[model samples]
Target: EPEVTQTPSHQVTQMGQEVILRCVPISNHLYFYWYRQILGQKVEFLVSFYNNEISEKSEIFDDQFSVERPDGSNFTLKIRSTKLEDSAMYFCASSRTGRTGELFFGEGSRLTVL
Candidate 1:
């Protein structure tokens, strides 16, 4: 079975530095997303992409964050300026149809900002 893959299993960055988390979703899935979970909080939705455009995003996904499919296969999330609150496990996910379907998520890229 295919699965989402994320790089830099862990990352440490300065509070004002830029950070990029990468992911490779399942080859045939069309929907891609970025979600995050603070140390002891619930997973929160950040953004969703489809057809090369952002389909939906939450208020938490401010101007500082961005998502793109750089190479048709690799999806990336870029945080222009990392903040202490941005430290969390960023997850990349994809589903065959949409949110209602089973979403395959990567092991997650842990970001730690100081």
Candidate 2:
């Protein structure tokens, strides 16, 4: 079966530092998305990419954040500056179709900022 894979399952960083979270989605999947959940908060959508461009994004995805598909095989999210409030569990997901279809999610990449 195909599944999403994330690297550095857990990351610790200091405020004002930068972090790049990496993910590899299912090979045949077309839609990719990044979401995050603060320690005790609800999961929030960050951004969605398709066809080598951003398809959708939430207010949480500000100038400090950016995403890329460097090699067509891996998708990455870069946070230019980390903040204490940025600590959260980030999830990578993909689906054969768009939002109307089922999504497969990676375990999660936990980010901790001090």
Candidate 3:
């Protein structure tokens, strides 16, 4: 079965640096989302994108963050300036439809801000 794939499973960066996390979502899926999990916290939705525009975004998706589907198969999240609080597992997810809310998550891009 097809699955979402993420790059650089782990990243160590200094606070205030920029980082671009990459993902290739399932080919036929439509809805895309980004979520993060801080070390002992529940998964928090960051943003959702569809049809070249943002569908939903949480407060966590502040000015420091942006997302793009630079290509037909690749989706990317760019952090303009990272912070210590940004250290977490950033998961790229996709769903066939929103009705089921079934998200298939990539292993994750672990961002470590020091």
Q: Report lDDT per candidate.
A: 0.94, 0.94, 0.94
lDDT of 1 by residue, 1-114 (tens): 788999989999999999999999999999999999998899999999999999999999999999989898999999988999899999999988875658889999999999
Per residue, candidate 2 scores C-alpha lDDT tens digits across 35-64 of 999888898999999999999999999999
Candidate 3 per-residue C-alpha lDDT over 6-108 given as tens digits, one digit per residue, 9 for 90 to 100: 9979999998899999999999989999999999899999999988889999999999999999999999999978999999999999988876578999999
> How close to the true structure is residue 104 of candidate 1, measured as C-alpha lDDT?
88
Q: After superposing candidate 2, which stretches have Cα over 4 Å from the reference?
A: none
Colliding pairs, model 3: none
> Which pairs of residues collide in candidate 1?
none
Clashes of each: 0, 0, 0
TM-score of each candidate structure, all chains considered together: 0.97, 0.96, 0.97
Error of 3 at 27 (Å): 0.2
